[model samples]
Target: MTDGTTQPKPPRPPRRKRVVLADSRAPVTVLRTVLELEEQTSWAEEVVRGFIRTQFWTAVKLALLVIGTLGALPLVFFLAPGLSGVTVVGVPLPWILLGIVPFPLLFGLAYWYNVLAERHERDFVDMVEK
Candidate 1:
């Protein structure tokens, strides 16, 4: 069966690599081919490195978000009282403002936000990477 387009198909035969000597008459063509292959390899390596950089930035952004969340936890509590009635290191529940609750709270919020932020960043990175 043939489609609307009329085109002649070429026949395929041998599928093997023939070793060419250095002093072959078509040696120049072989050298050109080698250079083209090298260029393609270099381009591929650059693309790989670009992808790596994108991943690296994604990690750094996540780390900063985690640190910021942990650091700001105290501020969140300070701005709004009646959140927790637990004393933390010589400080009143949250009114004294002496210390920012325990590390667990900070760590928890940081941990949670870090994960959330990473998911968001990853979504964005995925959209851009492609």
Candidate 2:
């Protein structure tokens, strides 16, 4: 009466350290791996500080560019009043510059910021992962 089919083996216990809950019948859960920063890890701290400095400088540069451009509009208009009178298909140059031009310029700046931030993050990740 032996058909020769072998039975499956039982599951093995987990290898990692696990903490069982206070409940009488609760299952054991594996501990999550956490980053230890309190120890003497000056290299990691330096890398983080450098990354933050790079980000801070990047933001300051972009802000100066945007603010400088917008701030110069009044000076340009003041210096060259004729520019405000110029029209393109019945719309004044000032209207075009102030209303229509900024959207694309802002979007371009935002795109550049996203690219730069991603690059910074990628470099940071590579340094840490290595």
For all predicted structures, in order, the TM-scores are 0.33, 0.68
List where candidate 2 sits over 4 angstroms from the true fold.
1-40
Clashing pairs in model 2? none
Residue-wise C-alpha lDDT for candidate 1, range 36-126, written one tens digit per residue: 4457677545654675676677667757766676567678777766655776675566544334444455577557656865776676445
Taken over the whole model, the C-alpha lDDT of each candidate is: 0.61, 0.79
Give the candidate number with the greatest TM-score: 2
Give residue 68's lDDT in candidate 2 (0 to 100): 96
**Candidate closest to the true structure, highest lDDT:** 2
Minimal lDDT window, size 10, model 1: 94-103
lDDT string, candidate 2, 1-130, tens digits: 7689977888898789878644444333211101322342675577678999999999999999999998899799999998989999999999999999989999999999999999999987665544
